[model samples]
Target chain A: MVNPRLMVWLKGLAAAAVLTVALGGTPSFAQSGEETAHATDAVEHEAGVHDEKGLPQLNTKTFASQIFWLAITFGTLYVLVAKVGLPRVGAVLDAREAKISGDLDKATQLKAETDAIVAAYEKAVAEARAGAHKLLNETAVTADAAAAKRIADVVAGLAVKQKEAEARIEGQKQTALANVRAVAAEAAAAAVAKLAGVEPDQAGVDGAVDAALKERA
Target chain B: MATDPLHQFRIEQIVPLHLAGHDVSFTNSSVYMVVAAVLITALLTVGTASRALVPGRLQSVAELLYEFVSGMVRDNAGAEARPYFPLVFSVFAFVLFGNMIGMIPGTFTFTSHIIVTFALAATVFVFVTVLALIRHGMHFFSFFFPSGAPIVLAPILIPIEIISYLMRPVSLSIRLFANMMAGHTMLKVFAGFTITMIGALGAVGWLAGAVPVAINVALVGFEIMVAFLQAYVFTILTCLYIRDAIELH
Candidate 1:
């Protein structure tokens, strides 16, 4: 569609230019010089009339001149825009995009590094906690063993003292009983001798004493 | 007829000035150009500054102008020329407004003059050529020679190509100038006829005058279309030229 429009425009321009040239130019020399001059004068007169009416009279020379100047103006403007303005705008946009991308990359790298550091720190802390807990448990078990050993030693020492005390009490009781029996027997013999008054036979006295002693035992 | 339309083209001082022993006449053309410049500035600034999501009428018009030219450049020259949007847009607006504004009762259509149109055309021509040169370097000269042509045809084909290429600015400038001048002139002639006919005949003259008046009305509509079309054509050609420069085919 755009191509067609351009073609149409170019066609129109060509036709208009051709018309202007044909109208402006001198007629062919095949015609007499007089006819040529008359044709030229007629064209000039027509041009004058056109000028008075403020119409563009077809003139190739003027047309060519106009084209020359138009080209100059358009060329200058194009250079200014294409070379100067466009490059500046492109550069600014590029710089902005680069800045944004660079910042994003930096942020990503920093975040990764930070995460790694945090992981390392957390691992160290967990290891230290585990070590401390293990040490506490071992100390508690050792302390319990030591306390039990001390209590066992105290009970054994008490048992040995109790056994020695029992043996001493039994020996004292036995010696006291023996001494009391000796005293009673001597008293009995003296009493028996005083009551009897007569000199009895030694055998009878001995047999009676043996009988009394046997009965008392 | 004015001795010189170029002479008529002057930048007049709004304030009187005595500069280097010259008596300068402050003309209507200068005042209008200034007014046009100011008008363009105010319009674009005010229209775009609001930057509304749902554009107001004025802003929409501004946006439409921007989109239209940008679209043209994109479509005609391809996306690579997107960077040239502003330049293309500026040319469109300036020429479009300049042509339309001249249609007002008493305004000078600078575009009607050959010099102004030629200036615009020549600028496009030079830029396109320069672009081709810059992009292709010495190989840019190949553009004047047709591809896949026999060596025997070079003599005929090369001259034709060269002439056609050289004629671009001429065609571009004249197309605009001739259209605008002819359209305006026709309108003026018809308007003059309508008035003169009405004055000559009493009641009947009004009936006769209606012919030219109706024609003039139709011409007005046509001229409006032409004004816009001419501006569009000018910009589109510029884009094509730029495309050729960049692509060098």
Candidate 2:
């Protein structure tokens, strides 16, 4: 929006300038012979009057000059304030605002980047967790299979050893029984020969023993 | 009444010197102006020197003054106008102090005079105008002849705009000057009545004097309000002026 105030000031300055130019620039320009005469008469008429403060009455001689200077003073002041002072202030304000906005933008961009990074990191972590779970499952299955196979191999080996042990025991027992029977027979025959005179009837005895043994068997 | 108060308000030659082919007389008013300037500087310096986190009364007052002006500028001129804070703040402080100081029994109120107020107002005006011209170039003139005005009414509207625009300094100066002068004058008149009445019949004069004294006290309070109000008005106008110069619509 146009500053109504600034416009007003500019308009004042413009008017003052226009007036000055139109009135012929400065008091000297306006002070023609006729105007001076009229001024002198006006001043003489008002001379001896005094106010409550004992001050002399007004004079019209320097009226134009007063107006001129008033304009000049106002114009000069206006220029100084408008041209020099205000702009400096404005620049400071603009700079501060720009700085704040720039900071905000930087903050926003950083936040966005951080969020993206966090999301990607989270995704990677999830993938890693999933892979780890899959590996653990595969390891568990492989371990179970190896354990079962080992157990079966051990059971088969024990069965084979039991069979061999039983066969050995049976063979040894047969051998031992044969030996014992031979020894007993040898001893009994010897005793009979020595103690008794039964050796002459060997053929008859053998045939009888054979017939008895066959009947007992 | 004098066509202008300048003639009536002359500072007689307390000390006279001629310089640069002009008669220069250092008068009481001139001395006071110098004094006022120095006072402002000293007050600001002393008030702000400590720059305390928790302020003393003097510093608090100074800081309040600063905030008040800056706040006005921000509100009226927009956030973008923050850079102008110091200028606005200083102007407010100077004018405020000048007005208040003038109220003291023996102090001169520079703001009470038209020259000082006009000078201040004119400066604001010129500043804004130049800003507009620089920012908008020839288009700045369009401010006087607003766009979309019906062609038939342009003549009347243009003159009115011009007159209103020209009155900126006059209105600005008059507002401050008139308020200060009128208020002070009323106080003086009342004070005179109070004194004069006191010399009359004992009880009745005493009672009459009491009325004017009470009124004077009330006027004093009112004048204080006017002092701050004028400062606010001036600063806001400055912001508005800046906005016009910058935005032009």
Candidate 3:
């Protein structure tokens, strides 16, 4: 660890460096001194312009004041908000929520009621249709029965008229037949009387006519 | 003066007051905080005043905010988390309003402050811890070493779990604070650069400054997105924390 020659050489080098610095450092030092003066002057001027030194935030003296005011203001705010602001907003929101759900419930109820009404209307219409059908059937049956009775009465009257006409025709035919017999009997008696010159017995001729008519019957 | 990017975060006292030897002065941050509260309260109250069956614009926004947080609680923390809805809602509205209101120019961002974010995170941490203790009793300690994990690994895992659990507030606070502060700072820096460039180099600077302006224009949209995203992340994380406290998983 102890190198004597190297130590001597290091000591000489240090002496030479010191000599060099001593000789060379004077002008630089003088120059740096002027620069330092200028720097100080600038710093002084800058300091003069600024009212406060350093960061205002770092100023510990103002901490109490800031903290104090913060507490007061923050405290006041908390009170106002907790007591007034939040409740009001909460109330409004709750009210709006209640209103919405209530409206929805009402809407649902109305729809149900409407559905019931529509159902009732449909049922009434169905009953009316059934009643109308029944009425129509009853009217048709009554009209059909009346028409049938009228037709039957007309046919019965026509049958009676036909019977009476047939009886009259039969009576007329019998009368004509009686008249023909009478006329034939008269003519025969006259012919006999004219041919025989003497008056044939009228009673006898009448008796003969009667016997011949009886034979023909 | 306005060129300083950090200038925006500076708290200016609107009403100087001292109480218990502590400077309790009402500042610009407080004003915006109050304004956010008023706006949130007004939106919820006035918007729901009509109780219209069909909501209008304001009512829609109010209802959306309500449902969004409620759904978040239900989905993330489960039905058991229902009781905490108001607290969760308040936190969400406060943060969302803080972020969105900050996006407006010349407005102070309260969420950008570490103190405010830390307070919120600490409150959540305490709440969850207390809830766990109340609900689960001494069994809450079981959370440090996950069940089914090898008990032999308890030396390694328990510390890790504990550290991570304790780090919840730190991570939560830092994340929100850092994001808001960083995004706003970057916006301011770019805006200041644009002004400085235009002031220093005239026509050439105008052309050069347009680059930063364009970037800043894009950044404004990006910052707005970040604002909403960070708010969501914050609230969702809170919901998750509530879930953890309730379930101890």
Candidate 4:
């Protein structure tokens, strides 16, 4: 804080410097300086009366050359940066931006393609399921029809066998009835001969057998 | 002269050339200006000579500087100042380098000089004024008189505006000059104290000098920051003034 006050005196020194400069004194802009914190200890250490100069920048004499070089140097740097440097940096940034956007576009495109392929695969699976269902239904119907035909063939064959078996039983029954009648006639004739001395005639026996068979039927 | 904190600011003729009754001789201030220019050119041109997409440390520094000034111009001056990008960048670089180079133990700080800072400030002042004149015509004078104000207020406000406008260069030049000059002189005084203490106090006195040396070291770092800040102030102000001239508000 005490040190900062050193510049307080500089306000005057600066004014004096500016005044001297304005009044056409020596090129002594150097008089602009801060007082030491120990101004009391400064002890009048004066280099010369001319030594305590104002701001050197206010000097008229050096202005020409300094400005001259300043223009040339600063101007050249300006041109270089304007023409070359900024453009290069801009290009790098632009290229990076373009690359990023392009990559994003490509990613979107790939995602779209993947979605399309997935859709196609889903459609194929659906069609395959429908085709399998139709096949299952058609096979069931064909199996039913074949089973019905087989059952009909077995019934027809069994009916024919049943008719043949009934006819054979009827024939055997007729033969057995004829044989019993003939044997009965023979026995009756023998009994008559033994007990009453009479053998019956062929026509009589036949008549008797016919009458008996009719009664039984 | 070493004891003289102000001696470093002394201007002495090196080549002593005179032409057309004008003393245009190259001096210490002139040499530093050239040194600033060369270093800036090297920092920019050689630093970015490869122009790598991925920057090295030096190139990053160069690119950072470029973008820093670019951002300042864009922010304060608006996009119309895009064309003036190089000029602003150059001024920022020059002032920055000149100020920083001056911080070296035994070198000259040209920016501390009012002559150099004033010329720069004056040039900016002239350029902006001309720009306002060209773009706004006589309407530029209306800048002194605030718009939407009572006509009675014009008498009060116009002169104030014009005076402030004219004082722009003075303040611009002085702020940088005073800050640099004071800081440098303060450092020199402290350094002189440290040296004097070490010499006068003998073997044990060397330890007593540590305080000043430590403070001087801290001041060096602070001055470096001030160097950068002052350059930024100078450049940004230029941008704002240019923006004002262009927009005429």
User: By DockQ, who's the top model here?
Assistant: 3
TM-score of each: 0.55, 0.57, 0.82, 0.75
Q: What 10-residue stretch in candidate 1 chain B is worst by lDDT?
A: B3-12
Report the poorest 10 consecutive residues by lDDT, candidate 1 chain A.
Answer: A46-55
Model 1 regions more than 4 Å off: A1-217, B1-26
Candidate 1: what lDDT?
0.66
Please, what are the lDDT tens digits per residue for candidate 3 over residues A6-118?
Answer: 35444544654564465356434533644665534543331112225445564455778888888887888889888999899899999999999999999999999999999
lDDT of each: 0.66, 0.63, 0.84, 0.77
Writing each residue's lDDT as its tens digit, candidate 1 over B1-249 gives: 222332232222344433343323233433454455545555555665555545678666755665577679989998988766767765776678778987786676767766667777876788788878878999998987767778887897777677678888888888887788778877877877777787899788899999999998999999999999999999998899888888876
Per-residue lDDT tens digits of candidate 2, residues A1-217?
Answer: 3357457656656755664364334334434566665544544432222111211112222222323333443334334444543344344445556878998999999999999999999999999999999999999999999999999999899899999999998889778755644554455456676788455354544555556556775
Q: Using lDDT, rank the candidates from best to worst.
A: 3, 4, 1, 2
TM-score leader: 3
Measure candidate 4: CA RMSD.
7.9
Residues A1-217, candidate 4: write the lDDT tens digits. Answer: 3224334434645765675465344332222234432332322422121323543444455666666666766666667656765566555556657878999999999999999999999999999999999999999999899988888888888888888888888888888887888887777667767787877787787788788878998
Model 4 has fnat of 0.36
Candidate 2: regions farther than 4 A off: A1-146, A177-217, B1-24, B35-94, B122-159, B189-218, B238-249
Per-residue lDDT of model 2, residues B115-233, tens digit only: 56777788779877887898899998888877886788778767777777768778787678767766766777777777778776677898878998898899899988998788778
Best by lDDT: 3
Model 4 clash number: 10
Query: Which stretches in model 3 have alpha-carbon errors above 4 Å?
Result: A1-51, A183-217
